[model samples]
Target: MESFPHSSACDLTAEIGDYQQFPNPGAEHAATERTPKPKLRHVRVVLLSFGLLCVLQGILNVALRLAVREPTDAGGTEQSCPQGWLMFGSSCYYISSQRRSWDASRQDCVQRDADLVVINSTQEQAFLTGFTMAAWVGMTDREEEGTWIWVDGTRVDKDRLQWARGQPDGAFGGEDCGDLRTMIDFIGLNDFMCSARNQWICEKTFW
Candidate 1:
């Protein structure tokens, strides 16, 4: 074999070692291919940030819904009455359909732990008037011929009494029991006979 000079061979060996240890441009490019591009890395970061924002928004919405909820009554609980009874300002009122004498109707109300309605306010009078049927109230003058009294042993207030036109005439017979009389113009009271059969209203208090 043809041999080079000692210095030249040493120089060639050094060059070969350098080529093996230090990579070329193509090898460097291949190494860089393993690293993620900047644009792609930025896109991944943006997507992660958006996902975190969505999760936070969902949590915030749930918290807002809980914050706006209506509060319940923390004081004494309210009570209710039986079916077919109406609730009006802590009182329960019931209008019966069955007809009975004034005394009999009053006894029925007493058995149910209530009494005949004694209207004290204009609102109550209006409400009672709404009922088309003429019903017996608690007002009566049976104890005295002219002194009106309620079933609760209270004197009747003259100002609060709604008397129909030409009432208390005691036409046909003497009228002692009071009733809600329906007339052409408006609803008012009329003295009715104690033995007359009529529907009645009962009232009681609730919590």
Candidate 2:
């Protein structure tokens, strides 16, 4: 019943024998499972971890912004006024409890990072009316007689402010410095001597 020659059978058997030492499919699968993963897989894991951290950082930034946001109001938030200062119309006034000559008063204001008050509006005048019966203001005409200017070097718009009736008469040869008078009947602005000692008002405005 044998169809192949004896030599042909022996050659076939030799070829089969050569394959005997080769690993089986199951062994190949086991070896593959035991092998270490590719380095690119580790790099991918690191990248994913970094991406997660970045996302967390972004969330933290958003939380901080929300935490630091302040509520605003219609008239805007009211600013804090320093001690011994009175706030009125976005400004603060420092009224001295003692008296000093106009020049010395202004110097003191300068030392305090402020200047003698410049009355800008009738409302401001009313707010400061009773601070003292009289106080040295920033008005002066030392540079030119009758050409009154504020300490800030701006021309005094005489008409823009109220003057004590018939006052600022340049009385006593020259009343160059100005004062605010709140005495019952004599309440208004008046020109006075620069050397006169009187209470003073310093003003600082905040924007």
Candidate 3:
């Protein structure tokens, strides 16, 4: 049997005890700290990036909402005339409430940059009838008696003109200016005196 010296044996035992207590602990601690720091930094970067993306997305959504809220004039919001004016076909009509003579009524229309309604269609005449029982229109034969002409200097065609039965009879002396009469059975065009005070219709073209 081989025998070790007591001092040597004691030294070897001390070395073993020291190794057992430490045993690469510093390397293990260094690896744990170094590895976790990078992983935590990466996680922080990912979190910040996700938050920034969410903020950008929110801003983009708000911008889109504002753009969609804008209005356009082509969407039926554009009107050819001021409020209370009736828009029919390509023209706008305004029925006057105040009664005036034919010349005065026409002057009033001219002041508004319009003229007495020069009805060219039966439909237009019918539409005017719906607004009032009687209104001074543009027709007059004051320039040449029995030769009816519109205010625009256009000759009144027989086919386009609608007259009540036996109307324009030069009734009550001599009839001159035209008026739409809506007296139930007498709902048609009739020549009346130019000086008679009655409501009038004005018209203007727009597109």
lDDT of 3 by residue, 1-207 (tens): 999856755465433344345559889999888777777889999999999999999999999987544232455564456556786666789899999999999999999989998989888877788678789899998888889898888998756768877877888888899988888788778899889998999998763
Identify the runs in model 2 with alpha carbons over 4 angstroms from their true place.
1-78
Worst 10 residues of 2 by lDDT: 10-19
Candidate 3 is scored at a TM of: 0.61
Please, what are the lDDT tens digits per residue for candidate 2 over residues 1-207?
A: 869745755475433334356669998888878874688679989999999999999999999988644444367884656799887776778999999999999999999888998888888888888879899999999888889888878887778777888877999888999999988778889999889899999988774
Q: Return the clash pairs for model 1, or none.
A: none
* Candidate 1 ranges with C-alpha deviation above 4 Å: 1-75
TM-score of 2: 0.62
Better of 1 and 2 by lDDT: 2
Candidate 2: global Cα-lDDT?
0.85
Q: Which candidate is the best by lDDT?
A: 2
Against the unseen true structure, what C-alpha lDDT does each candidate score?
Answer: 0.81, 0.85, 0.83
Models ranked on TM-score: 2, 1, 3
CA displacement after TM-score superposition, residue 52 of candidate 2 (Å): 53
